[model samples]
Target: MASIGYFLSCEQFGPKELIDQAKRAEAAGFEKLWISDHFHPWNDEQGQSPFVWGVIGALSEATSLPVTTAVTCPTFRIHPAITAQAAATAACQLDGRFVLGVGSGEALNEHVLADPWPSVGVRLEMLEEAIDVIRLLHRGEEVSHHGTYYEVQDARIYTLPAEPVPIYVSGFGPQATRLAGRIGDGYVTTIPDADLIGVFKESGGADKPVQAGTKVCWDRDAERALDIAHRTWGNQGLPGQLAQTLPRPRDFMDAQALVPRESTARAVACGDDVDAQVAQVRAYLDAGVDEVYVSQMGDDVEGFFAAWDEDVLPALR
Candidate 1:
């Protein structure tokens, strides 16, 4: 059975607003919650980057639905040791309802510390080493690692969940997908590229869960909604230098400002009808995704929920 989840861009919503939304998602019967983990906002114009960990802690008390980071970069900005500790604390705080979704992050987000961005090959190696560090720490073991990318000195996590936390790797390329299969407890990706699963299996992943999502605005005024989404999130379509790596989400906004409106329109589905939004999500499921997360774009949060709650979700069930 495919579980349906709601996508929350933490950078877009304030802490209080996010908690409120999570509460509403639970009340509306959402089973899972997916939140983007970015260190920076899309641009100075968008203007928000609340710490994801703090927000998740609030969410734990705000709702019962399990939470997953849509994808977090395991390389660069934060060391695997620090991330392992944060994940452990989160798993404990969320009481087994949290999943750590990791990836080999882009240089834009990972290279902001004035450090030279590593090459893709190096990034993959870092990802491999980081995973080892994280998995070992998640096991609540006293970990001592000396690797090409990271080093941990007799580190142990005593506060993690009783069971090891589930680690899902987000991948797009063949090597990364194979790495996911070999190391990840499950796989996470934005699009349902059937080839991704094949890559995972061929690389080593077999019988792992696949989670994906599509974005749409449920608005009678389609153009207005598309305009906002493209203006705010279009950098998501860019292969490099994303909102994460950019100094601010608004930096992305400035960059996105260069793209033609049609480009943003292609990635986002905006419409007044609920069926339209649901169909967009259905297409992802049809692609063999095990979970479909719907990103509610625009300002009509109430309407978005009503449509999905009354029409889309029931039909899926």
Candidate 2:
């Protein structure tokens, strides 16, 4: 059976609320935690974006559950060397229960510093080099490297964990998936596509762990839940590279207008129906995922956890 975890949405809730949710999730039987790393929320409606490293530090003291960044873009917004140091410190704080999940970041976050957002191929190349830099620095040795995409001079993370942190790569498409399989300690994605999992395994990720995340709104009023889902996360329904290229929350607000409410209704599981919630997560586990993390998309955090504790989690287990 796959492990079930809670996804702490830094995009939706503030740091204190996230910490509270982390504790609630642990008490509610979640086996682990997945927290998003973002400089900005996809849209202003989502409303919050805390520095994930600081939240992770509080989480280290708040909950005993393992924590993984659902995805961080170490290539552009921050240098991979700095990311390596932050991740190392987080691992030590979490008592070795940290996973640095990285990806080719979106323009919304990466472009904030005025860097040009490159094409997918170039971004992937940068990600590959960034991963190499991170791994080299994680070795606890003074390292100086002038790579094609990055440079580091005599950098060493003094506050290292007993073991180097595991770096999981996030992939939403075939090329990234192949790269993740070839180099990642594990794979991270949102879709529960079995074919993609097969591609990962065949690309040298055989027997490695696969983690996935999904969103749901657990409410008594299904229509209200759907409304919240559509209003807050309609950007999720946008197809293609719009998510990658859109540089601002207002841009997303405009692009997400193209996404119909019906699409969010289909993409996100809504209502207090335990069966629907279980099925949503089961799809990932059925796809050979080793861990499935669920994020609540409504304001009824207490109700969501209550339902998960009483019904959804039990059924899945």
Pick the lDDT winner: 2
| Residues 1-317, model 1: lDDT tens digits | 88999888766777887787787777777889998777776655445677888888888887888888877787788889988888888888888988899988765566667667666677778888898899888887788898887889988988878778899998877777888888888888887688777788677667888888667766768888887787667776776435334554545666777777787777677867666666677877787788777777677888778777888788777
TM per prediction: 0.93, 0.99
What TM-score would you give candidate 2 relative to the actual structure?
0.99
RMSD of each: 2.0, 0.7
The lDDT values for all models are: 0.78, 0.94
lDDT of 2 by residue, 54-75 (tens): 9999999999999999899999
Candidate 1: how many backbone clashes?
12
lDDT of 1 at 110: 68
What C-alpha lDDT does candidate 1 achieve relative to the native structure?
Answer: 0.78
Off by over 4 Å in 1: 239-251
Clashing pairs in 2: none
